[model samples]
Target: MEQSGGPRGPEGNEEARAAAHCYRHPDREANITCTRCERPICPECMISASVGFQCPECVKGGSGTGHAADANQPRTLAGGSLAADPRLVTKVLLGLNVAVFVAVMIQGDRLLDELLLFGQAATEPYGPVEGVAEGQWYRLLTSMFLHQEIWHILMNMLGLWFLGPPLEAALGRARFTGLYLLSGLAGSALTYLVAAPQQASLGASGAIFGLFGATAVLMRRMRYDMRPILVLLAINLLFTFTWSNISWEAHVGGLVAGAALAYALVHAPREKRTLVQYGAFGAMLLVVVVLCVVRTAQLTG
Candidate 1:
């Protein structure tokens, strides 16, 4: 007698046959086996290959196994899950900014001296910026996430909520985050170079300007109408120049950084895409570091 799921075979008097079935679709009888694994697979599970049909398992087995080599293909660590949703980066950024803002509100003016990017304002004539001269470069990054007032936080976060998702999706999580942080750092670098040592500056405007520039550049690259973004940028520039106590230097620096970074990402050749993009980003950051060193020397001298 032949088993229920097994293919029919010649049987001698009272002998039993072992049942065979598809691994994936157990209910369906397997007509063919995978060429590589030799495992039984139903019609739906078959993947046509050059030599013979393969099972779905066999095809997916190459991922992260060093067997596949495609530059643009997404990589996965061993036992790691799939790529995260693109929007996750945006949400996390917004959350961190908001949380820091609340902490600033609670800490009052106490945290300002530590968090705000005050460049020379902390030096000799203006009095030393506490953490910066003490080898704390983190203040530059801290200022980007700090918002002094409720409205300041609101406007910046609103801009992030509005613009971050699409940009994140286009750039992928790592690239998008690199663009954002580098842009903000560029803003602070410009601020350190130009702002009066005694003048304090904080807020996300510079970083926000970066996103604006990125959006415009990305849109232009995609052959989409950039008029709306251009108009919006113009309006913001007007505010940046006209508004009191705003660091136009940071805004412009961030805009330039973001645009440059986005350009590298958008135009990089597919074959050397990652290498080119990261190299451009590193070069942009190196320029900022040089600017910081030069400004520090000038201030100290």
Candidate 2:
């Protein structure tokens, strides 16, 4: 008599096993099973554990002990928790810049006008007024990711790819992100304060220059050779002064902010490292805000 509901044949069993789906993502196939829970997990759901890969739930629950889940997690040099993907923040920032560049390319000058850093100006002559002085403060932050020219985005993204990952790895994601944004804000504030009120500026060059300064500080902190970065920075500064269309204010402002912030982040006393680092960030942000406030007064007065 034929077996009723018996075990599957070898090939059938293999096929059934191969068809297993991730518990978290039903649509996705999963081959690796979580060591802790024995749940099938896709790559995205896999978390490296002491013995083998674990699912997010298992990892979050720890090793069935009373200890904190991340108690044994590694820490970065700057006392931040080491991330599974050290360059994740860098990748996201680069992607944002590229995405903005693509959007600008498709939408043309209208999008650029809305995003660019400007003190006070209209999109066109006699058009509805815009710019930071007119309460369009978002421009200061948005302009950091905006780019018009292909070459401009290319250069900035290249700098980010090279410099960002190392900084992110060293300082950890949150601090690195803070450094980039505050530096960019510092640049925008300087440009608003000094440049012609109606003058327009947009680029990641400010943030890139900020990365340069941070890299120098990080290298020095690690006792690495200073000559290479110094030479590179010198060349960039020369170009900043000599290049006709370049905004020297943005470059200078970003460089100073990044250097100062990196110094505090890497050199803060270990006893109060977190407080000092965050305080430095707050101070930098305050400086940027103060500059914008003064400039706004001048423009609106």
Candidate 1 accuracy as lDDT: 0.71
Write one digit per residue (lDDT tens) for candidate 1, span 1-301. 2332432234411122123456655564554565655556543454444344555555666522223332123321111112446478889999999998888878887776678787544434466445443456787799999888788889888888877866775676787788899999999988888887667778887888889988888777645567888998999899989998788998999999999988888677655667888898899889888988887777766
Model 1 scores a TM of: 0.72
For every model shown, what is its TM-score relative to the native structure?
0.72, 0.77
Q: lDDT (CA) for every model shown?
A: 0.71, 0.80
Best by lDDT: 2
> What is the per-residue lDDT of model 2 for residues 1-301, given as tens digits with 9 covering 90 to 100?
1111223455533443455766666665556666655656554454544344556565565652223433355345566666778789999999999999999889998888889998998788789888999999999999999988888889889889988987886788898999999988898899999999889999988888999999899878755568988998999899999989999999999999999999998888766888999899999999998999999999899
Give the Å error, residue 48, model 1: 22
Model 1 ranges off by over 4 Å: 1-84, 122-134
Off by over 4 Å in 2: 1-71
Query: For every candidate structure, what is the RMSD over all alpha carbons to the true structure, in angstroms?
Result: 13.3, 12.1
